[model samples]
Target chain A: MTGSEVKKLFYMENKKGVLGKLKDGLLKTRRNLTERIEGVFGGRIDAQALEDMEEILITSDLGVKASKEIIGIIERTDPVNLRETLKGEIFNILKKGEASLLTNGHKPAVIMVVGVNGNGKTTTIGKLAKRFKDEGKEVLLVAGDTFRAAAIEQLSVWGERVGVKVVKHKSGADPGAVVFDAIQSEKAKGADVVIVDTAGRLHTKAPLMEELKKIKRVMDKELPGAPHEVLLVIDASTGQNAIEQARIFHEAIGVTGIVLTKLDGTAKGGIIIAIIRELEIPVKMIGIGEKIDDLRDFNAEEFTEALFE
Target chain B: MFEGLTNKLEGIFRKLRGRGILKEEDVLSALKEIRLALLEADVNFKVVKDFVERIKGRAIGQEILQSLTPGQQVIKVVHEELTSLMGESYKKTHLSPNPPTVLMLVGLQGSGKTTTAGKLANLFKKEGRQPLLVAADTQRPAAIEQLSLLSSQIGVNFYGTKDGDNPIRVCEDATHKAKREGFEPVIIDTAGRLHIDDALMDELKMVREKILPHEILLVADAMTGQDAVNIAQRFDEALNLTGIILTKMDGDARGGAAISMMAVTGKPIKLIGVGEKLDLLEPFHPNRMASRILGMGDVLSIIEKAEASIEKEEALRLEKKLGTDSFTLEDFRGQLKQMKKMGPLSQILDLIPGLGKFRSEINIDDRELIKVEAIIDSMTKKERGNYAIINGNRRKRIALGSGTMVTDVNRVLKQFIQVKKMMKAFSRRPMGGKGGLNIAREVMKWQ
Candidate 1:
């Protein structure tokens, strides 16, 4: 078989596996949300069942405002139609926020991954680098998280693991200079996509947010309208604070999308439901497991089906 | 976002206060508000239900009837319950009688095990105990290196092997090395994994068996939501965790997850990681966390409350006014109005400890403040802009116009110039991690 044919076969097989993995990855979340909702669900939603449904939705981390609104819309549906209506509501919200990661056209498409401490910013960058590299494109990783100890080493290790080059400076070096240098490098000129990994910072820290905004300004200075994608990597376990993180990060540095990570755990990333319903920021990708291949594009229809089915 | 639980309760109580007498419907309404605040704070619905029940049982009997402010009484009841439920007494983690006490740290992926391990070692080292940082986290690449580098930075010994596969073996060898080297405590930093990962869980159990550590701390994120209970229960059930260490406490998260895990797993939270710096780890104080959670009496919470009360735009405007040399009487008048809205001065002093001296020196009479504002209002725009332009005749005219003595007008003008000089100095200093009003509040607290 030719390389394209082999690629086709791999994609065909991986497509099924990807959906299954997405389902399996989100199995904990599905069990956490759908099964409980289904258990409390019935025709002619009783007061007790409605309250239980609301409780489950709130506890699932759907957030109070979103849960209240979702339950309000679902409770009005006819009996026996509740399940489908709930599914429809979620699908509509997820659908509005669904967008595939597309960095094909922009020269040196820069994707900057940012989040609070230990939200998988570096790992997500590594996975993205591998994904882009697998698509037969030159991928370059930038170690912009210069604060944490051995953060540059961690990115370089990912670079080696994925067979890519990493542009970095010493630890404690200014991240703006690092980003500027990375974009100016010859490797970046030839690379199709340059992924910049920022230091994990809580959005509440004004100085840290200012630093991120400064680095973002640097990106624009070097390449006008650069950092084509500012993906906020939020841990799935994060609750209501995800909204705060999303808002502050978006307000300060401008997040184009969210990469919800650690979904293989029980967390449903229900904060995304809150994020899209409130902020209108689409979730473009999700990190399911530790393996690099565990990363996948978010599918609204299939993800909704995973919970229902 | 996490300013106060009292605000939510107060809002509901305000609604209740509008009605003269409390009725059954009002009680139910109050419970609903408490329920929603806890839920939004990320408290588990089950725990919240129980807590609301307890509040109903405690707050309704004699408390509400005798209380002057029903809202304050209800907030007090909830605050007391939260503190008690979270375990009020603060105690350090009990060190084992034997030397080389092993501390095994575990948690979910990206939960800050490596950095927390380094912090634990640093904390123990600072306490005059030689602790060894064992890099048993072989899963994530460069994680061992990260810990090793931290060990170097902190001047602590580290143990790890290149074999990298068997975490149990690495932990075993590290303990033996710690024993030989006379390091008082061996902190085993385990790789973060999902609690449901049976294989990895089993591996962690084996490492636990091998080390037979005195403390198995589940390093959890303070920002964890409702699932904190489930995760904590699983780790507590699986490894029989001795204590819990909550990381990232410096964030704006209300840290309700601390309460959830404490209520469910019944494990003492040993330490809290306040910042990324290794030295930022401190012993967990439940009463303080309870206050921190409610945004009640804690110093940080009060400062944050002040920040929340002072609008960001107003702060920026104040910063701009201070930036230029033209901090006028108009800005000083604005500051007075802002400080009035910061809540009762006496109550603020009572809430913040170590301010007893300030309490005596700063006599904040609202009427006097109003008179001062009137004095400022009586000044002309040019005189307000350049207080230096104000003469004794203008001061006498201002006092007569504002219904105050000339001495009062002189005092107001003198205070405004001093405040201008102080604010200018603050604005000149670099703002490292604080905003405009926050820096102001910090200086006020110190003052």
Candidate 2:
């Protein structure tokens, strides 16, 4: 089957399952951000209630700018049906920013993943590899994060678990060279997709970012117009730093998509809206749990309802 | 990004200073700015609400201070309130008088529990106490090896099974070994689940029961924002945690967890993991952290840095000089050279109170310090003892010798006279003797 056909089949089989996972994943956030808003709405709709709702959104890790925008939408809409107003506003923001993972409908789609340390970049890569592989596409894992102590080993472990081939060099090897070799192998094996994992360096580190630029350049040099998707993985629990990270990474290497992780663990998952609204980057996927299948495609309506429900 | 809170507060304070007298509307506007800062920092909304309310109650009906702007007065209140909210002072991890004080670490996965375990062991070893590391996190792949690697790096004793041993069994065996080996603290690193699952809590509960640890520290990632609060609450309910080790503090975390954890969980944050290195562990001081977050500069930390860098007799002599009218330009230049020994002049300036807001604007170039040193070097002993002796030709000669203009010498002499007067005035006050003097008192208390 073609990739689109496979995706359609998967969606058909697991639409309800995906929503159920999202609901379960967002339980903590709902309690933290929405339940308080619900309590405020249950009372008389006054200016105090409006300010309380605004406070809830801001405390939920939504950026000051996005939260104010949301509050503005709520104020313009009906206050009696606060839940509906919030849902509509959040849905609009998320839907406007929604984007699907681009495959390019070509052989060997190149997806480069980057993020700060401990944001689950390698795990996301593993999950994506398994996902495409399950859809009957050839997947190749590139262990481009050679600077971290156990990063290569971690990627290799995930590769082994997923039963896909991992292209890696020894620890401390040149990451650009690793990506170059991985792309060579992808073409040699005729892989349908190659997911490259870069080192999780802080965005403030200039020399390391220079290294990332070099890797991107190498990928394009080896295969013209490669690195088809520069996916930035952000931890959902991140506060304002999420926006800053998205801006810097996007500016430095051109982040094409976002993979938000650790949604199940934090109420700060409101950062999703902040990132989407502020950066205008599509959140292609959201990881709710540590399991490989815990990831689900970003759905604006589903996410908005999940928050309120 | 992480500095956003400090920057915002500074802007608010600047706006507040722009207005002359203390007004209720000004305080309200300032409180609103503070509310946004706290919320943006990921502080719990309710906590921020209560914090702002408390500050508002104090700020709104208070007499204005003649010594400070209304903005500075509000900032002082906030600094004190934040300090108390975070817990007043540094809390040392309670060590049992008996040997083999057990410390079990528990938290959700990726919060740096394993690395923090290694750091804690390294900290204990540095204190000349024997610490045995127990790798009880058998569930995660390579976790045991990770701990063992850290143990080897820190040269601490390690206890783990090559084969898959249950966490409870491993912890029990490690406790036994610690007792037999007379290790002062047995630090057990436990497994972490992605979420709070029954199986994971059961496993942690079993380990806690088997070891009966003296301290259960939740190694939370400071970058996790509000999640850290929930994680600490859950772990505290389940394990009755003694303290917290907030890891990844050096990251661009808004530090809401650091601000809220103690208030929410009622557990003092004992240590913080500032970096990935084993030696990067630091004692958590609420006052210092609060001051740092407020951009008021952590004067206590700077004083500690000074105490570490300068000899006791030298500091005492400087203090005596300040108390007497004997603080001359020679001693001023000597003090500048001594301060330079601690670190870069810019960094040193960051630790001074009231300087953080203008830290970026004021450029205290290290080269400028050298010029000041050169100018002071060119002065005669009599002229150095009393700046009044420096006539116009003497100033011109000193400026020429230092490769600077006569105006440079005049500026230095003027600033020296001002600093001497300020020190003379500060030395006599007992209470509320300026922000800098209070910091000096805190350092003396620490000593």
Clashes of each: 0, 0
Instruction: Specify the CAPRI tier of model 1.
Output: acceptable
Q: For candidate 2, please provide the TM-score of chain A on its own.
A: 0.91
Give the TM-score (0 to 1) of chain B in model 2. Answer: 0.71
Clashing pairs for predicted structure model 1, backbone only:
none
Tell me the tens digit of each residue's lDDT in model 2 across B369-423.
Answer: 6777889999999999988889999999999888999998998887777667766
Score candidate 2 by lDDT: 0.77
Question: For each prediction, how big is the interface RMSD?
Answer: 7.7, 8.4
lDDT of 1 at A189: 94
Identify the runs in model 1 with alpha carbons over 4 angstroms from their true place. A1-16, B13-21, B62-73, B299-442, B445-447
- After superposing all C-alphas onto the true structure, candidate 2 shows an RMSD in angstroms of 9.3
Give me the runs in candidate 2 sitting further than 4 Å from their true place. Answer: A1-16, A28-44, A186-189, A266-268, B17-20, B63-69, B162-164, B303-355, B358-447
Cα lDDT, all candidates: 0.80, 0.77
